[model samples]
Each structure stands twice: as structure tokens, then as C-alpha cells.
Target: MSSTDPDVDHALAYPEPPASPLWHRQGAKARPLTDAQKQRNCELLLLAQHKPRTHRRAEKPACSPT
Candidate 1:
């Protein structure tokens, strides 16, 4: 089989970088965080900690004993 198929090459191409999150931009700035910003950051941290992907467990299969 040929290793240079256009479809395969397209699929293998490097993906675009993910967009920066809100905190990333804030971190880049030198200004101190405000009270509201601190609260927002805390909320974001809590959300990230408990987000579905982070907290989800492997779903159990339904019982099917014969």
C-alpha cells in the first residue's frame, strides 16, 4: 500500500493549536487580579475540578446474566 495518500496526509497534518483560555491571557498581564477576577478564577478552578470529563467514571454495563 502507498504511504502518501492525500487523505492520509491530510489526516496526519498537524492540528491547529487550541485557543488560549481566559486565565491564560490574564496571567500574561502584569496587573494584579481584582476581587471579581479572583472570584471568577476560583469559580473556573472549581468548575475545572468537577467538570464531567474529569469526574466521570467508567459506566457500568447492565447486568446480563444468563
Candidate 2:
């Protein structure tokens, strides 16, 4: 009847379930990027880095009692 009984703990314990079938699946292998693709990626990265960010301001409620 003791709470620390090992037999009670083992009776209530359950084994861990197996992982999903997708867990062991492998997707299509990726191909290496071409030189032109690499250059284009670099240019796009630079443009994104230097792009100006605009801040949005909250406007007053349209229908307020005067």
C-alpha cells in the first residue's frame, strides 16, 4: 500500500511508441547550384541587406465624437 512501491510503478509504466514511417524516409538529393545561380543569389542578398525599411504609423479612429 506504500506510495514508493516499485511493483505499482512498473505496472503503470508504458513502453515508448515507435517513430512514424516518415521519420526514416529520405527525400530527393539536392543538386549543386550553378555559377550563374550563385551570382544571382549574392546580388539578391546584397539588395535585401541595403533595402530601406519603412515604419507604419497608426491613424486616428475615423468616426470619433467631436
Candidate 3:
């Protein structure tokens, strides 16, 4: 019944900020995307448009892996 239970706050624990696929600093600035790169990225975007989104249908049993 307490909020401290893992089941109660697991989603909030150590939550990290969303990452941007663009404008990240770790990698060298993507050298101006080549024509090939632009084509590939556009194709990938189109391919991804057809996949269904995933979602947990049942409660994700708590994991204790450490």
C-alpha cells in the first residue's frame, strides 16, 4: 500500500530525458549528409512508416536482474 514499493514508482525511478536523434554532440557533426545518405534516410523513414507500434499488453512482471 506504500508508494515506496517498486511497483508503485518503477517508471519514475532514474527516469532519463529523451534523446534527440538529431543534434547530438558525441558524434562528429554528421558531415553534410551525402545524396546517398539522404536517399537512405528517406527510404528508411518510408519503411518505418509501415511497422506497427509496440506496447506492453500485460503488466511487465517486475525484473530483478542485477
Candidate 4:
């Protein structure tokens, strides 16, 4: 029962500490994108979504060019 005992009981020890906070306490603000940046982002996103993907394979080994 002593605090400084060499073998303390399991139940008497303090429970594990709570997890640390993940997010910042201060308020977050959203910034508007510039017109040029917005246009570029839109074009990039459209290109990514509409990209053409082709899988080409040769029947046999490719011949070396002369």
C-alpha cells in the first residue's frame, strides 16, 4: 500500500494519458485563388479526367531500326 513500494499493485497505477490534440486551436481561413490560377487548375483537372489511355503491345519482339 506504500507509494514507494518496490512492487506496486496493478490497479493503483494511473491510467494511460489521453491522446494529444490533432488540430490547431486557432480558426482557419480560406483564401480565394487568383483568376489565372483558377483557370489553370480547371484546365488541369479537366485534362486529368478526360485523358486518353491506350495499351499497345507488339505480337513479337520489336525490330531494331537501321
Query: In model 4, where do residues sit more than 4 Å from their true spots?
Result: 1-26, 53-66
Which one wins on lDDT? 2
- Backbone clash pairs in model 2 (N, Cα, C under 3 Å; residues 3+ apart or in different chains), count: 0
RMSD of each: 15.8, 16.2, 18.9, 16.8
Per-residue C-alpha lDDT of model 4 across residues 1-66, encoded as one tens digit per residue: 686777855784678877677654557777788776776666555555543743443234333222
TM-score of 1: 0.34
lDDT of 4 at 47: 50
Q: How much lDDT does candidate 1 score?
A: 0.56
Model 2, 1-66: lDDT tens digits are: 676766543553677788989777588877988877776666555555553742432243232222
- Can you give the lDDT of residue 37 in candidate 1? 76
Give the lDDT of residue 13 in candidate 1: 58
Residue lDDT tens for model 1, 1-66: 376655443553578878778546544558788877776666555555653646543344232222
**TM-scores for the candidates:** 0.34, 0.40, 0.33, 0.36
lDDT of each structure? 0.56, 0.56, 0.55, 0.56
For model 2, the stretches where C-alpha displacement exceeds 4 angstroms are 1-25, 53-66
lDDT of 3 by residue, 1-66 (tens): 577666653566677978876656675555687776776666555555544743433233232322
Order of models, best TM-score first: 2, 4, 1, 3
